[model samples]
Target: MKTITTAVAALFALSTAVAADEVCMNASEMQSSLIDWYGERPVEGPSANNTRLWVSDATGSWTLVRTTDEGKACVAAQGRNWNASMDASDVLSEIAENTES
Candidate 1:
């Protein structure tokens, strides 16, 4: 019984590790996609005045794109971890605060 319990625990640990790794990989891929889309683009200033945020899960990959003012704010506030799980509006608020300062 002890051995069986130990084996089950080991299996559970392995499963958890695998799931974490997958999540990390997905996050990294999403970051890469966002960077590619916004490379060399300023996230603030006049260029960002009309920006918008775009979220997509196409290609089995989650991606966030910022286009104009609000989009620029979200990216600036949240950095590369921006995704579907994030509250983009909250990020915009942070950006607003930052800009006011």
Candidate 2:
């Protein structure tokens, strides 16, 4: 009845949040030989290089993604390390942790 419906809705919401929060904190986890990574070079406006488009990986199991063009970023796909590197740590999570502290 009404209680069951509410419980189902709550479960759905909780599951989604948990899935998103499983963000891979390591940059190396974002790479896979199955898919390709691009620089996204744009001729006009801010360089597309500032933005990245990481697409499908083998079996497409988990996640990691980062973008610097503002707005926000969500973990897109995760795999063994395979791209440019920088200081380690989940970029978005680190940002959130820093801001909260």
- Top TM-score: which candidate number? 1
**Candidate 1 lDDT by residue in tens digits, 1-101:** 46544433332232211122222223334346555754422232232444333333232122223343222222322233333343445444434444453
The estimated TM-scores of all candidates read 0.28, 0.23
Give the alpha carbon lDDT tens digit for every residue of 42-80 in model 2: 111322333233422233222234433453444533333
lDDT of each: 0.34, 0.32
Residue 22 local lDDT, model 2: 50
Colliding residue pairs in candidate 1: 50-68, 51-67, 51-68, 51-69, 52-67
**Model 2 clashes, total count:** 1
* CA lDDT, candidate 2, residue 65: 47
Model 1 spans with C-alpha error above 4 angstroms = 1-49, 54-78
Question: How high a TM-score does candidate 1 get?
Answer: 0.28
Best by lDDT: 1
